[model samples]
Target: MRTVRLPGLERPVGAIGFGCASLGSRISAAQGLDALADAHAAGVNWFDVAPAYGAGDAEAILGRFARGKRDGIYICTKVGLAPPQRNALLKQVYSMARPIVGTLTGLRRAFRRMPSTRNVSLPLTPQLITDSLHSSLQRLGTDHVDVFALHKPAHGDIGRDDIQRALQGLRQAGKVRLIGVAGDLEAAQIALANRDTYTMVQLADDPSAQPLQQLPPAGGPCYAVVTHSILGVGGTRERVLHALRMAGPAAMSEMIRLGYSPKPEQAVAELLLDRALAANANGVVLMSMFGARHRSENLRRVQGTPKPEALQWVSRLLAPVSESRE
Candidate 1:
């Protein structure tokens, strides 16, 4: 496993991390535990989890796996916008509201970039930040976590300053070793510039995100990079198929004709092993590995393959998209 030494945290973490988001919701407790074991045995030392992920069950399951061997792992957890309380009617309403709200918001944004359509932002107040961390610590069954990150904020939310300050306090209090942001492209660039305030930024590390290649190296306090969605949400195969079908048959055919091979999603992940090593990411967190048989194949790809030359050649083939977009 490749490793990057984060400055503020003073820990060298694996280049590939396991994200335990679907722990208790989709995968059974036994399955989740087994997956965690496999990841650990495979040299994945960094584990990322959040309360919003499986109605708090994800973190609970992670807590169980992290109990006896906390020292050997680097855990990162997030706070804000928790799962709705257990009220059947409320849960039903929430389930319905989520997709509707998202679709409507997308349509509204497409129609007009109106300020009125912005989402309500929650502030990371001193008490809220402190209390949330304490709760996460309890659930994680650990005293001090290696990194504490903030989830993506809603529109019009200016929570960065407050969240950074809260993270600083946590570092001072020895509750959190480093402060980071898990957000979109723009937010991550902003956080990267604010290295004195935030220690790391976690974001998508897809080929489309080539601009980040120019980010200044961790010169000062060493801003670590933790990437997720590197395989694209549903993994490469499914995501490319969707993009092609939705974008058009002509585009898909052009992509194929240009020498973009249709490798299984796992083969796509094999490409990332080298890229993660090259990018110096502290870790690349993947979602569940047992949700689909393809995912297990992906895990095997990450473990068995070393395809540096293939990735370089593919990057050359796709250079048009990478360069023209820039």
Candidate 2:
């Protein structure tokens, strides 16, 4: 993977980042550390973690694993509600609900526990952003973060000059090399367009999902771009092939039946890489390559065969659909 530059960041990061969301949640701490070590050894420089993941265990584990290698990595973390402390009741509630009910009720529970005012937080705000940075630094045992993002803000939270001011202050203090916002791209675009506060932007540019219009380059010096969920997590190959089958794409069906199989893992990855390149993205945050077997598979997919010349094909496939909507 090639490294790309972000204007204010002290170091260029690898094209593929390691997302730590699943590390402490679905995996054990020692195993997560092993995965981190594997990623680091494989030349992956970007690491993305969030407070909302694993109730702070993921960051703690990453900090332990990254102890002496601070300068060699680009550590990116988010500020948001920390994952709730797990309880038997909450576990039982989650297990007994239908999928939709589970989602809605879980969200409601989370919202209920969130601070009513944005200013009141996990550590309370004497300095707000600075306090959060110090807390993250202490946990990660680092002097500075390469990129720090406000994970996701409330709907009416826009135009909050206080938040903007706090982020700018972080940059000046050298606590964070760059500032960014993460969530839906539309909100990110609105933030970047309306304010010059952020140096880089992170968003998904995967093809399978409804195409999101890319924000035109911000010009001048800027962090290239970092994105996640580019593989369209839920848009697996089986789902896509099924859709194509239903639509009766005779050529595609023939290709499928003849064992001209486009491996789901490879095809989806290719689609992600293709779209990111199209969007002029510098790097992406990729997660879930934990086990040694999984790691080997990912490395093979990422580094094995030559990348196809896919831009032209994807453009032709998508142009008519986009044009029809316009």
Candidate 3:
């Protein structure tokens, strides 16, 4: 429930944001709404969703949850992508597959990163930005969203005046409170480089990559940052474990003494998550906490103290290997 005074924000944004990428896809409406309510009850005021999320049903469910509470919460939804239209049979197939995928990690990982066949990114144009925002507004049941973002945009798109001007117009027209770029590290850097045109940047925070090192620390940059993929995504979990195993018993013992779990995977997960929270102390770190367990655990982590030693461990592990002595 801890909050930060992010520049350009009317309200203090929660340190941990609720990620709704699986709202209506892996989770049912009833469950998604309940999760949203639980998060909101726990003082989570930031929600991150997209047009392509939850097979395009997340925004509507979130809109429903936001009824009478829109002013109390901050919403960031993205453009440039839409869900693929699924017929009744395919929808049923997805529903039946959810439980199986939940139990099988391999099946989940296979489809986790695979782009949907029909869900596609649209060409970024002024018309597309305006039209997309209009549709999103209708779905969100809000006239103006807290943040409007370009979904995984290309570098060229970021440089286009037509697109930036379109976003600026949205702000001028009172449709979007702020504009941002949400993509890989490159996309975030691109947006950060053009801070004049972008107000926020959303990207993954990998422990091994330590991409956040490239940016000025929290409260230093004018633009707000929203980081995601703190756990397991993009093989970060494995990389953390790899680093620990290679670092040998002394590092592991230190981690254990520092209150990390002895089990390597869990220890690595905790260290990485703690480091992310510490790194983005003044920013928002997105957590896909659809389940009750994840919600409680992550909220606890958000409220917990930052572990600077954890940050140092990850940075050392991920830092480039020095070349052999001449």
Candidate 4:
């Protein structure tokens, strides 16, 4: 429910942004639209989508949700990586599997690994940049998007003069209000270096790495850092909990009381989210919002995120023996 300032946009963005990567794919339109509406109603104004997202249908569903309310929300969609191309059999299987996997989420990973579900998108080009925005605008049912980003670009793509020009032209034309890079740490670092073209950078918010800490302090640079992949690392929660146990009862109790999660796993996750937001206090954190429970949980987490003491507690708990002693 908290808000952060994002340069190049007239409105301040919500701290928690809804990610539409599963909109039309894992979630049906009926539930997806309702979920999006719920998020918007809960003060989550930022929605991240891509042409490749939601089996290439997320933008349309989001568009349906944003109708008439366009001015109130911020949309960030990306180029590069189009949707997966599937045959009729796969499509039928996907349709049938959606409900099953939704209930049995553990199976989602297995489904994702099934062959030929997604298509490998073409490499970035100036024309693809121009063409993609037009298509995305159409799908999103908006005249312009708040942020248009390159999806997982190669190391060299960020500084390419032609690619830079393409993004700039879109901004100048009002097709996109801001240009950004959405990828890993390396890509984000490159975007930071090429601030002339990139005003935003989206990357994973890993606790071990704390990548978003690279952003300049408040009022120093106008760059908006959007972080995702928080708590996505395998076994991170267990690892943190183990370390906390090693630190003794005080550390565990402090984290649980501060996080306010009924379950230890949820509490640890909330603590991690707090650390990520603290690492980039002025930026947005993206989370997939399809299920009502998880959506509500994430919305609640943002209000308490960037909790400095919680971050400090987790850092000390997870610190190495030598460093923590120091």
TM-score of each: 0.72, 0.74, 0.90, 0.92
lDDT of 2 by residue, 1-326 (tens): 55666677656666677888655544567778988898789888788887655445678888998898988988888675556555334334433432443246356445345543112224323275677678888888898888888766553343367777788788888888878776677757756664567766667655554334566565664444667665554444335434444434563554445333355434434444554454444445465576676565454444432234444434434444455235
Q: Which stretches in model 1 have alpha-carbon errors above 4 Å?
A: 84-122, 154-162, 233-265, 272-277, 280-287, 291-311, 314-326
- Which lDDT tens digits does candidate 4 get at residues 255-278? 666546656667777777777777
Model 3 C-alpha lDDT per residue in residues 1-326, reported as the tens digit of each score: 67886777887888999999888877888889999999999999999999988878889999999999999999999999878655344356567887886567788777665655246778899999999999999999999998999998877899788888889999999998889999888888778777767879898887767688787544445888889888746676886688778878998999889887798887877777788889887789999888887788778877766667767777776655562111
lDDT, residue 258, model 1: 43
Measured with C-alpha atoms, the lDDT of residue 5 in candidate 3 is: 69
Ranking by lDDT: 3, 4, 1, 2
Q: Write out the backbone clash pairs for model 4.
A: 84-118, 84-119
Using TM-score as the measure, the top candidate is 4
Give candidate 1's error at residue 148 in angstroms. Answer: 0.5
Separately for all candidates shown, the number of backbone clashes (residues 3 or more apart, or on different chains) is: 0, 1, 0, 2
Ranking by TM-score: 4, 3, 2, 1
Instruction: Give each model's whole-structure lDDT.
Output: 0.62, 0.61, 0.83, 0.82
Candidate 1, residues 5-97: lDDT per residue as tens digits?
A: 666655666656788765654356787788788778867788888776654567778989998899999988876646534434433433445
Off by over 4 Å in 4: 87-90, 215-221, 245-250, 321-326
